[model samples]
Target chain A: MRVTFPHMGTMSFAMQAILENLRLEVVPPPPITNRTLMLGAKYSPECVCLPFKVNIGNFIEAIELGADTVVMGGGIGPCRFGYYAELQQEILHDLGMRVNMIVLEPPQGANGGLWSSISKLSVGQSLWHVAAASYFAWHLCKGLDGVLQSLDLMRARETVPGSCDRIWNAAQKSIGQARTYRALRMAEKEIRQELSTLSLHLHKRPLRIGLVGEIYMLLEPKVNLHLAERLGYLGVEVHRSMSVSDWVARHLVPNPRARMHTRKVHEAARPYLRGFVGGHGLETIGESVLFAEGGIDGIIQVLPLTCMPEIVAQSLLPSISQRYGVPIITLVLDEHAGEAGLQTRLEAFVDMVGARKVHRGGGVSCAK
Target chain B: MPSKIFLGLDVGSVSTKVVAIDALGHVLARSYLPTQGQPIVAIQSALREIARALPPGVPVAGVATTGSGRVMASALVGADVVKNEITAHATATLRVLPSVRTIIEIGGQDSKIILLNHGVVTDFAMNTVCAAGTGSFLDRQAHRLGVPITELGELALKAASPTRIAGRCAVFAESDMIHKQQTGHSLSDIVAGLCEALVRNYLSNVAKGKTIAGPVSFQGGVAANVGILKAFESALALPIIVPEHYDVMGALGVAYLAQPTAGQTRFRGFGVVAADCQVKGEDCDGCGNRCEVVGFRIDGRVQAYWGDRCGKYSHVNYLSVGT
Candidate 1:
């Protein structure tokens, strides 16, 4: 069966690896563009978050490209994401597009969990083969995240303009083409070495800003308008509060170390938010506080408009910003968001934080 | 010998403001002209007026552009510095009042509130996805009421008791104003109500959750309306300081910024006032992105390209004139 899935940053590499290893033909959805957003918005219910619209857009594009089966992750929360798959399926059906949907939901009590879901997809493959494929995919996911994390740091200090971006594009291409675990590891090492050794403005101490928000908005460059890259270009060191590997480690895998980190994050958030408001709401607050205490100059919260959890997080962020004396800016993005407006806001925000840093007697010059 | 002067242009949605400042930040010449949906024409005319006002052969030391059309203006004029209006506004306000803590800027299409601590911007918020609380809405309301926009403030100040109007949405606000008028409310009261409604909208939306501390300074095109200024004062319960060059503050601010860039400026002479410049937008169907690439042409030769998500079109040598 030909399978397709929605794009979420570099998670596609892992998804591609898993499907290709399982002897499945994978039709990767086209890179998100204006047309994708338009298609998604046209099909999606008005007022749903931007991610949903983008997902619908992906499905339509993939379907047109001969993708008959769709694989999507499922969630259980106060956030609208939990019901997206079901709603999307109905919408596609209504549009007279005949496609089979396989939802990989979080393993609950009785329904034979993720193993059975994987088994369903790997019909003729041996259990051992499936396990090996999963292991390779997981490693690739971790490798990609590592490369990206280092790239974020390198982007701010790269002496040559657009050099970091060029390296990153090359890295993504190499990693995507790497079939074996050894090749993947080699690709990761090469990219990391290139990033670390790249010519940089060593003396330029850039403003450190932490990005905390809804997972989709934080991960999707198209949705957030390449916020991290923009900030990096503005000479701000971007620290992403969440990553795909982090999500997989916490949710998909039963990693005790990941659980320990999650527990610490929850404890940090306990003083401000007691329980989960769903969809990374508590995580957003926790990360901001942590970032502030970690001596970050600023915090930027990016979320799609009409996002409930982020809206709640946004309301509480001002208090955190005030308490920690870190400047915070919440960017609410939607289809209507203009690039010019975003650029203006980002520039102003950088200026504000830079000035604040100088005011605090920090010896860093505010880069214009 | 004529002194070197710095020129700053603010190409806003409604108006284009040009200011020529000497080395000491003294305004040598200033001109304000309606953008009238043609920023290029407005910029040229404003420059022409400023050229007329300045002494003959006074060389421009540097040039800077700000406001919504900043990029376009900079491309057209070969600006030394292109900055956002927020920074420009803050710089100017701080120059006027060093101890200023709050700035309420309501422009043609957008409104912003900037909160400062010790001359550094502590926090700021701009109106998002809505123009309901901006000067354009007020201008439209004034037009519907058969009053010149400049006269709106004077008429509003004459109201005995302002009528209540909805400030949530521009459409609703207009319908509510019409309803209040049909119900026999006086024109002055309705006008006064609009000023109050817009102020309320601005506070609840753009300035939401932002602490508006004093000493407050109000500036922008709308700041010229004394009625709106009074409404802002009453709503915030603080006396607002309106600087002498309030309308041209953004241009003035950039002009001050341009002072440092003197002698190394890319100030393509005052000849740009008569240069034939045109902008054209074409949709690139090369990929799914279909970026609407905008090309800036001077004398029918494409000088620059922008608005593409990918740098491909922007980087292409569109410079060859006859190609």
Candidate 2:
């Protein structure tokens, strides 16, 4: 059976690896562009978040590519994202695109869980084979995240402005072509080594900014206007509060380290936000507090326009800013979020952070 | 004649502003012109006006561009820095009143509020996908009322008791204004009501959740409206400081920013007033995406291409390396 799924930053790479390993033909969606957004927006519920529209667009493209079945992740949260699978199924049916939708839900009573969804893709394959493939997918995610971390660091310090970006583009292509876990590892290693060789402006002390927001807005660079790279180019080091690896570890794999990390974050968020208000809303507050405690220069929370969960988080941000003594900028993006407008806000925020740092004798406490 | 001067261009959707400043931040010359749906022509005209008024021997040390069409203007003028309208407005306000803590800027097509702490922008909120509380709305209403936009403020001030008008969306506001008129509310009262409605919209939408304090400065094209100014004063009960060149503050701010940046002047000279700039868009069918790429031409030579999703054709100056 030909399988397909929506793209979320680099998560598609890992997903592709898993499906390919299952001996299932995977039809990846076309690269996201304005056309994709337009198509998605035209037919989508007018008030649904940007990610939902983009996902529909991806599915439409994938289905056109002969994908008979779609793989989607299920959620358990106050956020509307948890209900997206059911809604998308209905919408697809309404659009006359009848295809099997395999939703991987949280393990619970009478629910076969994520593995059951994978088992369908495995078909005649043994459980051991599926387990091996899952192992490879996990490693691939970890490796890709590690490479990304290094790329973020290098982007800030690169002597040549576009060198890291050029290398990164090549590396992404190479990694995408890697068919095996060993090949993925090799590609990752080669990219990391290549990144290390690029000259860095060692004397430069970059501002550290934490990015916290809705997962899709943070993960999809197109959605956020490549905010991380834009910040990197402006000589700021960006640390995302959410990543695919974090999601994998916390939800899919659920290792002890990931569980502890989640607990710690939950503790950090307890004072400002007690529980998940849905779709990383609590985590956004938690990460802001944590980043402020870690002496991050500033925090930026990006959310799609009309995002309900983020609206809740956005309201609480002012108090969080006052309590933590950290400057935070909330950017709400829609189709009309002009590039000039976004850039201006970022530049002004950076200027304020820098001026504040200088005013505070260039000490880390300025961010506090 | 000054040894060094900086040029700042604020290219907005409805208008273009040009400002020339000396090293000490003294405005040497300034020009405001309607963009009229042709940014290139408007920019050239504004620059030509400023150039004509400038002293012959003065040299522009650097150039900066701002506003909605900043990138296009920057490419046209070879700008040293391209800034957003928020920064430009804040910078200009701070230059005039260092103690100013808040800025209420209603421009031609957009409205924004910038909150400042110790002369640094702490927070800001801007109107999104709405033009209910901006200059363009007022301009359109003025046209519909058969009155010149320049007389709108004075007309609003003459009102004894302003009528109530909904200030939610442009469509709603227009319909509400017509209803007020049909109900026999005086023209001045309706105009004043419109101003009050715009201010209300600004407060509820653009400046929502913002802790507005004293020493507030109102600037932008709409700041020239005494009606809007009075509405702001009554709404907040705070003394508002309007700079001398309130309408051209964005241009002034960008000029100030460009002054300190170390660079050779990229101001392609005032001769560009006559240079023909054209943009041509064509669909690139290299892939399934079929990106509509636009090429910017200056003096009949293609200078840059943009709008391609992938940099395969456009070669985007900014990098999108990571997924």
Q: Which candidate should be chosen as best, given lDDT against the real structure?
A: 1
Shift in Å, residue B209, candidate 2: 2.7
The DockQ leader among the candidates is 1
Error of 2 at A346 (Å): 1.9
Cα deviation at B244, candidate 1, in Å, is 1.8
Model 2 TM: 0.92
Give the share of true interchain contacts found in each model: 0.37, 0.24
Q: Model 2 segments beyond 4 Å from truth? A: A108-110, A362-368, B1-3, B182-184, B261-263, B280-295, B302-323
Model 1 DockQ class: acceptable
Candidate 2 backbone collisions, by pair: none
The pairs that clash in candidate 1 are none
Q: Write candidate 1's Cα lDDT for A255-318 as tens digits.
A: 9999888888888888789898989999999999889889999999989889999889888998
Encode model 2's per-residue lDDT on B1-323: one tens digit a residue: 67788999999999999999988889999999999999999999998899899999777789999998987898788788888787888788887778889989889888888887766677777776567778888999999999899999999999999999999988998999999899899999999999999999999988877889989999989988999999999999999999899999999999988987745776788888888899889989765446578788898987666766445544444333111
How does residue A95 of candidate 1 score in lDDT?
97
